[model samples]
Target: MSPNYKFQGWMGLDKDAAKGKMVWQEYTPKPFEETDIDIQITHCGICGSDLHVLRSGWSASLYPVCVGHEIVGVAVRVGSKAEGGIRVGDRVGVGAQSSSCLKPDCEQCSGGAENYCQNHQTGTYSSKYPDGSKSYGGYADYWRGPSHFVFKIPDALPSDVAAPMLCAGITAFSPLKRLGAGPGKRVGIVGVGGLGHFGILAAKALEVDKLVALSRTSSKKADALEMGATDFIATDEDEDWAAKHANSLDIIICTVDSPKMPLAKYLRLLRVGGTFVQVGAPEDRLPPFNILPLLAKDLKIAGSSVGSPAEIREMLDLFAKKGVHTWNNNVPLKDANKAILDMDAGKARYRFVLVNEKHVSQVERNEARENKL
Candidate 1:
């Protein structure tokens, strides 16, 4: 394999790319180093971040971006100095991150908190590397990056289900695990969408005394219960729902990214000394938060991002052993444009995964397309 392989994928040339205007064109990946690995992408989960980058919603995005992070594939080439014990042909996964400063003096790296690395943090896409090359994402046939961020997917977990877990699942799982959501603890998951569903499953896996699923309407009540939630709270349909469940939960993980969420009411649902962690990223400022409720009850409001690679490994192991699954709607890689629009319109049952069936069908098909010809 050569470093000059023709990389091709759906590239967003400008902000209008968010409206399904991406162009499928051949491009070039960053020059590889001994610490890198090339993956033949089999599945890439569509995330809200993809849309954000395409439209520069979060910040000025690097144009011509290939937006996707939740990636799963088989390693096609492993660099001699690649970290993480990765070898050629190993099935691995990459999430939102591609690199972080691993220097010994870095607080986050040395403290096992790479997610919060302050010195240097490179996203899987829409960022620049130290060498002045732009980072691409998994929306392509292949992905190349440092092996330290790649993780081995457990065999028991299917690739499709495991793809979304790379981002959405870890985003929710980290907070639940951090907030002491285990046996004897009553937990509530706000919103019944992708991240919330994972919160419900993780809480159940942690053996929480009770798990309550909260949503605006009763439409997802049955689904939530099936996902291992011990109870359901329909905020819009049930009168005094907040008061009814007030001081009932020991920990609450809010997964709704909408800015208009009932912040005060959600806080009321927390028990004394209970914690409320927001894992969802809202585009707008959160609704006016009140300090009264927080001070009166000693409630804690915190935020979390996607977990570190170590945390992802732990989550995958637990999912494989406990049979954790995601309710996903699969689409072909060619339909990513349609999939993104559908996802923005809330058409997914829970999550969406783009499968590169054409690339994964045969070893010859994969091997014939080398990154370096």
Candidate 2:
């Protein structure tokens, strides 16, 4: 049966949309297929990538885009060909990735590295389907995408709390779990913002011996410590911060989005043969730095995007078991403009999840519009 409700959400018409200029209205979603599942979204976490897409920072975004990838809601519709054992009434989630070429010959997908799928990987929003249909995001009351990317949320985790983990949580969790961040390891998380906070939580949950939160200043020292950090470092405030913590960590997860920060200094925090994984992306190209630390200390610098679906599932169970509370607040979907402006101003204590409080029929929506007029 077709949905009785219409698809409607906030849309950014131009580059100025990032400046709180998005308009609320109805928009077309991708056509449904047997492998697709429709979600009546209850919560969507606002990510830094949302702002980048809204302002065309990453690249020129297709106009009238809806930008949110950390999605959580109930499965209102499930296609017959859909996988993941999802049912219409099941609570579920979708991350940054919506589709990947799952050909048997596709080494990335077959090898469980779908995030690095070289063929036909589609983003949840601001991307195109293989059929050339425009893909939208979760900044709406409903979301429709391929079932391969939809995951069932664990019964123990709340939807609001589980939302960010799909994206930010996995982004941090993957490198740590993959690179061995647990017991006997001394882990360092760079930047205590959205992604960094999750990194600290994940590393702590993984039972790292020493979990240090590195940032530019002491403003977030109290917050980081409360998030299970064993120590905190203000790189800019302490003159000898780099030397003070030199060769102390076994692995470092860099989550700061800006490249202008201290790259060379961060590399110095790593011990001999340590691995540094950068999970954040800077808007502009990164500046040059000396490779002296890499040569002399045998340090390795790497990068990571969002994680694969399997990694996301693992992260969910870990967070649920550990009772990891994401430091965040909620905003009504109607005030998305103000929310975007506030997010740009760095006002979020940690992260913001947009709440879709109503899923009314079109007639009811029209009646409410008339009443407002």
Model 1, stretches more than 4 Å misplaced? Answer: 1-5, 363-373
TM-score of 2: 0.95
Per-residue lDDT for 1-373 in model 2, tens only?
5688778888888999999999888988889999999998888999999999999998999888999999998888999999999998688999999999988999999988899999988999999999999989988989999998999998788888889889999999999999998889999999898899999999999999999999988999999999999999998889999998889999999998675878888888899999989888778876577988799988898999899888988889899999998888899888889998998898887989998877423334655887999
**What is candidate 1's lDDT per residue for 229-283, written digit by digit as tens?**
9999888887789888788999889998777889899999888999989888877
TM-scores of the models, in the given order? Answer: 0.95, 0.95
Alpha-carbon lDDT, every model: 0.88, 0.90
TM-score of 1: 0.95
Which pairs clash inside model 2?
Answer: none
Q: How accurate is candidate 2 locally (lDDT)?
A: 0.90
Worst 10 residues of 2 by lDDT: 358-367
